[model samples]
Structures are given as C-alpha cells and as structure tokens.
Target: MQTEIIIAGFGGQGILFAGQLLAYAAMDNGLETTWIPSYGPEMRGGTANCTVIIADEEIGSPVVRNPQVAIVMNRPSLDKYEPLVKPGGLLVVNSSIIDRTPERKDIQAALVPANDIAEQLGDRRMANMVMLGAFLANLPVLSIEAIEKALQEHLPERHHKLLPKNYQALREGARYLAEKV
Candidate 1:
C-alpha cells in the first residue's frame, strides 16, 4: 500500500523535521519513502511544508498532488491542505493554534492541541512531535515504537537530553487524539 502525507505550518514549527521523521521511520521499517520540502524565502516565520510518501514498492514520483493524510499546524495550512486531502483520509490539526474544526464530511479528523500540550511538556517546539503522534494514532502507518526507535537513533546527540520529553509528547499526542475521537 502507498500512503502520501503532507505536513504544513510556519517555517520554524518543525514542519520539515516532522516529514523527515516520518521518512526515517518508514525507511527503518523497511518501507520505501520519499521526503520533499518547500518553504517561502522568509524562512523561520514564513510558510513551510513537506510531502512524505511511504509504500511497499518503488515510488515513481516525489510530488503529490493529493495526499492521503494531512497534518496542519496552523490555520493557513489548514485552509490550504484541508481540501487537498483524499476522501476518507485523515486530517490532524493543531487545535491550540487553530480556532476552528474541519468542515469536510468525507474525511476523518483529529483536533489536537499540540502547542498547548507541548508547552505543558516544557517546550512548545515539540508540537510537531505531538501532531505526528496524533497522526500515527489515527493512521498507524508507522507504529509509535517504530517512530521512537527512529527518533532515538537519528536525533542528534546534542539534543538527546530532550528525548524523554519528546517521547512523552508523542505518547501524549496519541493519547490526546484517542480521547478526542
């Protein structure tokens, strides 16, 4: 099976990193994957997004016109990618920063207060992990354990001290979404 996902948000919100993490997890799980990122010239505060595709066989293209899943971290991203999600697909939204819920009836949605959850966890930067966890909870394209292993192996040594919180954030995200649904 092939799954295409899009993660979008402000540049500094770890959008690209989230996509990379998914790619890494997929690869480590013996799946084929591709990660492609795009951002405005403004960088940090500008809009940023990435596309991740996971499949059991060779991938033909890196560009995805429509994705099966979308994790939007801001309202602008929600507006842009919401309609682009395939019918019956999953949408994971950062509820703490986004004021409203999704309108589509064809797709399932998980409203996660990622920023608030991460803030409570002692770092707002981990909102990406929260959102990623929420997505995994809904889709399970990659198991949480797989993701944790990928993170432990790939995250830079300098930031290893934050592993506990990050892992907590992932579990919290999954837990939060499970309850919300």
Candidate 2:
C-alpha cells in the first residue's frame, strides 16, 4: 500500500516530529518512506508542516501535492490542507484547537480532540502524539510497537523520561477512536 500524508500545525506543535516518527516507524517495518518538513522564518509561532510518504516499493519523490491523508492540528492547517486530500482520503482533525469542521464529504473525516486528550494526559504538547495515534488507528500501515521503538530511537537520551507519557498519549488517541467507532 502507498500512503501520502500531510501533518500541519503551528511551529511549536511538533508537526515535523510527528512526521518523522511515522517515517521511522514505516522504515522499521521495512517499508519505503520519505519525510519532508517545512516552516516559516518565525518558527515558534509560525506555520509548520511535513509531508510523509510510505510505500511498499521505492518512493519516486518526497513532495506531496495532494495527500491521501491529512493530520490537521489547527484551523489554518485544516483550511489549507482539507481541500487537498484526495477523494475518499482520510482527514484527521484536532477538534480541541479547531472549532470548524471539514466541508468536504467526499473524503473520510476523523475529528479527534487531541489537545484536550493531551491536556488530560498532563502535557498539552503531546497533542501531536495523540493525533498520530488516532490517525494510525485505522491505517494499519505501521504497528504501535514500531512507533514506540521509533520514539525511543529518535528522542534524545535526556528526554527519555518523557517517553512513557508520550506512549500514554498515543494510546489515548487510539482509545478515543476505538470508543468513537
């Protein structure tokens, strides 16, 4: 299977990190993967986005013009990428930050309260992880074990203490979808 995804949010929201984690997970599973990150000059508060492509065969390019999956964490991201999802594609939205809903009906939409879930987990920054978990719930593209391993491999040693919380956040997101569907 081939999946092209775009995860977008403001700079400090871990948009790029989320894409990296997914790519690492795909690589761990022996799938071909590519990740590209983009951001404005004012990183901290500016818009940030990343494109990730996972496939069973060799990837031809890293850039994604029309993604099959969109993980939009904010209103602007939703406004920008919602229109770009391929028909019948999946759109994972963070409802905690975005009050609006998807306008398109041709694609599947999963509204996840990622920020609220992360807050309940005691760290709002983990919204990305929550959203990631929700997005992975139905994709079956990568296993949670692979994602956890990727986190362990990519996170700095000094931040290892937070791994458990991150894992919890991921689980929480998955749990949300389970209960919803």
Whole-model lDDT, candidate 1? 0.94
- lDDT of candidate 2 vs native? 0.93
Query: lDDT of model 1 at residue 121?
Result: 93
- The local distance difference test score of each candidate is 0.94, 0.93
lDDT of 2 by residue, 1-181 (tens): 7999999999999999999999988988899999999999995989999999999999988888899999999999999999999999999999998999999999999999999999999999999999999998967688777899999998999999999999999889998999999
| Candidate 1 local Cα displacement, residue 65, angstroms | 0.8
Score candidate 1 by TM-score against the native.
0.97
RMSD of each: 0.9, 0.8
Task: For model 1, give the 10-residue run with minimal summed lDDT.
Answer: 172-181
